[model samples]
Target: MENNKQPQLINPAELFNPEPYGFSHSISVKSPFQMCFISGQSGGEGENHVLTDDFKMQVQNALKNLKIVLQSHSMTFENIVKITLLIVDHNQEKLEIWVAEAKKVWKGTFLPTSTLIPVSQLALPGMLFEIDAIAVK
Candidate 1:
């Protein structure tokens, strides 16, 4: 795909640079590209959909699941323009883990815009983290 069709990550001078946190302030996408909206993915696995209790594992698994969906469309993390993260019992430690996992997925300068929402619970028990993404190509 052409570079112009990719999402443009922007962190304005007036706004705080969110790169240290593993995201951008905003993203701009051009036309002549297809858009993909993925549903929230959690740490659950297998036919029974069992979720792991470990917070870091959950975060990793969630990102892995997101990647599975992206690959189904022949896209990668670089194609993602935005993501929404849900963390159960959010805290500094959990945030750090999430950022670390996100950095592993998005290694380049173009990080996706993200919104993190902390909640008491998720769709499934033992689910500690979830992530949904929007991608363009």
Candidate 2:
């Protein structure tokens, strides 16, 4: 059975609204909840970890992978409390793309707390984006 207790998504008025950026300021999860810490996922697919050169495709696939992971744990994006995003060569264009893709994934739902870090490179070649999340159940 799904738990009745729900996490509290916070966005204090004092702080700039972060929803447009596809995240909340913070999340307060109460007791008696199970937490799942998902590993960073990239656009790599299948056991071979094949990836494409397209940034949009990479972001889309990464989100798909994350959704699959969440489903495996009997959870959804709504269960996510915190998400960390890593982007290589982050820029205005990339940021716009990320926001647009994120909105598509988290559409009509409360977004999770998030932090995005721009790095020079990632662990693997052709990896432009990576996302990790913490979910509460």
lDDT by residue (59-103, candidate 2, tens digit) is: 998888878777765678888889999999999999999999998
Residue 108 lDDT in candidate 2: 64
- What alpha-carbon RMSD in Å does predicted model 2 have with respect to the real structure? 11.6
- TM-score to true structure, per model: 0.76, 0.76
Those runs of model 2 whose alpha carbons end farther than 4 Å from true positions after fitting are 1-31
TM-score of 2: 0.76
User: Residue 59's C-alpha lDDT in candidate 2?
Assistant: 96
Off by over 4 Å in 1: 1-31
| Candidate 1 residue pairs in backbone clash | none
Give one digit per residue, the lDDT tens place, for model 1 in 46-104. 54556778999878777766776676666799999989999889999999998888888
**Cα-based lDDT at residue 62, candidate 2:** 88
